[model samples]
Target: MKKIKNNFICKIIEKDILKNKHIKIRTRFPPEPNGHLHIGHAKSIFINFNIAKIYNGKCNLRFDDTNPYKENIKYINIIKKDIIWLGFKWNKKIKYSSNYFNTFYKYAMLLIKKGLAYVDSLNKFEIKKYRGNLKKKGTNSPFRNRSILENINLFKKMKIGKFQEGDVCLRAKINMSSKIILMRDPVLYRIIKKKSHHQTKKKWCIYPTYDFSHCISDYIEKITHSICTIEFQENKKLYNWILKNINIKKKPKQYEFSRLNIENSLLSKRKIKILIKKKIIKNWSDPRLLTISGLRKRGYTPSSIRKFCYNIGITKKENLIQMSYLEHFIRNDLDKKVNRAMAILNPIKIIIYNLPKNYKKIISIPNHPKIKKFGKQNIILRREIYIEKNDFEEKNKKNKKKLFINGKVKLRYSYIIKAKKIKKDRLNKIKTIYCKYYNKKQSKKIKNNIIIHWISKKESIKANFEMYENLFTTKHPEKKKNMLQYINKNSIIIKHGLVQKDIFSKILKKYIQFERIGYFFLKKNKIKNITFTCITKLKK
Candidate 1:
């Protein structure tokens, strides 16, 4: 078993279990099957699963599929795939809140029996009007005084499809005058007609609201530490209210930790959907989006995402983490783990001025600098080679450190070379650079300040790189009510590059580090577009 890293939540769970030997440590990752899990969900996934692992407990993969209107089986499977891809296994087959629909109805009846819930005849708009705002006390609906028998009859009719949609709803008879708006007689169940549930089909017309079903589902599953994001902090009250009023024997505890918020990242599910519907992005898995599949397609390792969650840590305090902070973990993950190779983004030809006509040999370069276990790969080094265009400059600028013409610059994994002369086109653009390789025996005599990477012209393959940047122009995209106004037009930029022909096979199989550039993953199917997503250029 992997050693579990300690955090504030872990400390709380460990101490709780230590204090009470009778307490069972069972946690869960409950995701609504409405949308794909995003980077925000990753934090919750790590926290719940890692905490359960630390205590030798079981973690359940629960789907909160109470709302059937917006959910489908495809979403359920995708969610399961994401959790498994994140390196976690459920103790049993996937559980759904809809599985306990019968029990939930029984609990609703229990609420009515105890005079804690009633079926409101008022329509949706009237209910909202009665439930006043933060500044005013809510007015009670006329049907709030309905007898328990009448409420039960109406609720039964609701279950039997006797009423149209929004005709009647079961709401908890909580304090309407209370300052907390959520406690003001929140709707427990609503009737949905015509639309069939993905799980339950047309057998039922009434479905439990998320607030009413979430806590009960936890109680039914015996979840010990019901952890969630801080945004649900207000719902914790309602969570306990349902379990408390129903007199549950074993009630699950709800705890909220700060969610992962990154600069310029749009995490809201509704916003993501609008973006996709508007065709601003290709899909939910577009590399610019923060969905787990998007991150995976962008070449982010699960281990890196886990590390990022741990690095951010768990807390009640809210903050926006810089995007660079997330990239740091990816860098650490890919640095030593991936094979290193040279790829020139902008190729410029360099010809050896005085080498032998038949000069050609394979230059061996280590796959990784420190890890010898990765072995090495050989590149054919002919008399003519291609270097990055930026590596060659016609004239030395003031306040410059080193010039290729005056001083010898070491070619990565090869001998140093000095630029003897440069040829230019009619427009005075650099066409070719004539250089001579310093003697290998006396290379130490040459003063070389910088090392440059290059690939052989004959041995390199052409490919297109689609580099990515932040999706939004501002740091806090949530602040902007109109998200389209702040769309980053330059989020993705395409450029042609030259990578070694030998590395393409491994690139298709594993992540490859482009020496001075960044880690890259091969884009599936498209041979010319051999790039997944680039994080950022390496800081030299």
Candidate 2:
């Protein structure tokens, strides 16, 4: 385990605990099971889990699946998988807000009996009108003065599905004149005639609101620290108010932290669903999406993501993390463990002149230059080879930096080669470059300016290389006039490439550096040919 630093927040938390200000430090990550987890969720999971780990306390994984209309078992399963993938484990059994439905109902009844809450019969519009503005006090609802017996009877009828949707709601009896709009007699329960919940089927019709259920749930779980995003900062008053009013054994402290926001991506589940529905994106796991599954499909390791989040550091202020910073972490991780291989994306055929026609040999190359014990692989050497087309220059007289006719360049892990002639098609596009190999031991000469990757024509494996770039051209895709217009049309470029045949014999999930190119992964397409997906590091 890494050492914990004495930061201000940590110090504050420790001081509070030392003075017996709070009990055991218990934190919980309460995610709504409506969509796949994104980068923002990663931050919350890290903070909650790491805080508990540091304090020798406990962190619970709780799904706030209150909205049955939007929540699903699929989302719940994916969220659990993502949290475990990021290397976190709940101290106790997984929990859901719906699990406390009966307890929440009892609490609501208690509030009604104590004259702190009541059942409002006003419709949605009338209820909002009575709730009033922030500057003025709201008028009491016509049913606000109903007898306690009458309110309890009506509430029981609501549970029996006798009330129509939005016809009645249970509202707290707090001051309606308070400046905080949320504190102005907020609704505790509402009527919803939607489908039954996954856990409870038609057991009750009255469902508790988030503001009412969140605090009560934390209190029930005995959570000492209720960590949440900044959006809930305003609701803190209500959170504490509920705890203070309720006869709970312990009161949980509500702390707010900035939510993670990535550039060029939308984190809202509704917006992502719209994109999926409109066919703007292929699916939730589209490479362009910032979901955990999307990043996994793009060949990112869980460790890389965890490292990226840890290095970004936890803070209260909102920060925009650059895509480049993420890429830098991934590149740094792959550089240490990935084996080196040769692959030519834009292949230009190279025919060696003055070489023995029947000669075929295998040249040994180190799998990793830095690790000798990692061993080597044999790459077939032949008279005909394929090199990247960009390696060759048409006008050698003017541009002397690259490989051209009669120019010498070293074939990586092999002898040096000099271009003798170039072949062009009818349109004058270079088709192939005829080169001649020279043994350095015999000639005592070498060229260091240009080094290129190549594969033997006889033993090369045909590969479909998909190179990816940023999905959006702008940093803020949501703010653009038309997000679809900002989609990088050239984000994915396909190329018919070739790699050493030996590279395909292994099924390694590990990253492999393609000599002159970038890192790549062998996709699980299982075709006779391999699909090498290029992992383009985001520039920092």
Candidate that would win on TM-score: 1
lDDT for each of the candidates?
0.84, 0.81
* Candidate 1 per-residue lDDT over residues 104-132, each given as its tens digit: 99999999999999999899999999999
Per residue, candidate 2 scores C-alpha lDDT tens digits across 1-540 of 552332345666888888998768888999988888888888778778888888888999988877778888998898989888888899779999999999999999998898889999888899889888967778888888888998899999988899898889899988878888888889999987777887787787888998999999899888888888888999999998888887775688888877777786777777789789988778878766778888877777778888877777656787777887777877888877778888888898998886788778778878888878768888877888998888888657664556887788888777888888888899998888888888759435663666778888887878888788777788877667677777778878888888777775432464678886887877744556678777764231
Query: Residue 443 lDDT in model 1?
Result: 77
Candidate 2 scores a C-alpha RMSD against the true structure in Å of 2.7
Which run of 10 residues does model 2 get worst, by summed lDDT?
A: 1-10
lDDT of candidate 1 vs native?
A: 0.84
The lowest-lDDT stretch of 10 consecutive residues in candidate 1 is 398-407
Give residue 64's error in model 1 in angstroms: 0.5
TM-scores of all predicted structures: 0.94, 0.92
- The C-alpha RMSD in Å for every predicted model, in order, reads 2.3, 2.7
Deviation in Å, model 2, residue 275 alpha carbon: 1.4
Segments of candidate 2 deviating more than 4 angstroms = 3-8, 125-147, 396-401, 442-444, 479-482, 505-507, 525-527, 538-540
